[model samples]
Target: MPELTLEATSAIAVAFAAVMTVGFAARQQRWGPGLMVVGILGFLGIISFGIVTRL
Candidate 1:
């Protein structure tokens, strides 16, 4: 496997950080079922495949 460049790693890190930061807003609301399901799913999505998607 090819090693990740600084840019690539930064992209993933920034993406992950952005998602988590935004996810905080998903809390502190009348979420009712009040789950982080969407955030969790998005986080998982990034971790699993979002960063490496093809054009």
Candidate 2:
């Protein structure tokens, strides 16, 4: 199995951070579940990307 590259990890981390931040902000502003869904999907997508790329 190949080692996980820093570039790929960083991308996933950044995406996760962005999604969570937006989610928290939305929750604070009472934006409801729609925005929360966006954040959740974004987070899951990033996780999936990491798993698919990682060995």
Candidate 3:
């Protein structure tokens, strides 16, 4: 597996963090399930990216 460039990893990490923040905020505000889905997708995307990169 090739190492991820620092910039690419950071960008993805930042996006993941931002999505998590939105998820928590939405939960606090009693937003519907859609926001939750977005959050989950964001998290899973990061995980998938990591796995694919490592393979």
Best by lDDT: 3
Model 2 stretches astray by more than 4 angstroms: 28-55
Identify the runs in model 1 with alpha carbons over 4 angstroms from their true place.
29-55
lDDT of each candidate versus the true structure: 0.58, 0.68, 0.72
Score residue 19 of candidate 3 by CA lDDT: 71
Clashes of 2: 0
Q: Write the per-residue lDDT of candidate 3 for residues 1-55, one digit (tens) a residue.
A: 6666879877877876777677677775656445667767877876787789887
Best by TM-score: 3
Note the residue pairs that clash in candidate 2.
none
**lDDT-superior candidate, 1 or 3:** 3
**Candidate 2, 6-55: lDDT as tens digits:** 79767766776676677677675766455667767777776676687664
Answer with 2 or 3, whichever has the higher lDDT: 3
Which digits, one per residue and each the tens of the lDDT, describe model 1 over residues 3-48? 5566875687676666556656665665622344554665576556
Range of the 10 consecutive residues with the lowest summed lDDT in candidate 2: 27-36
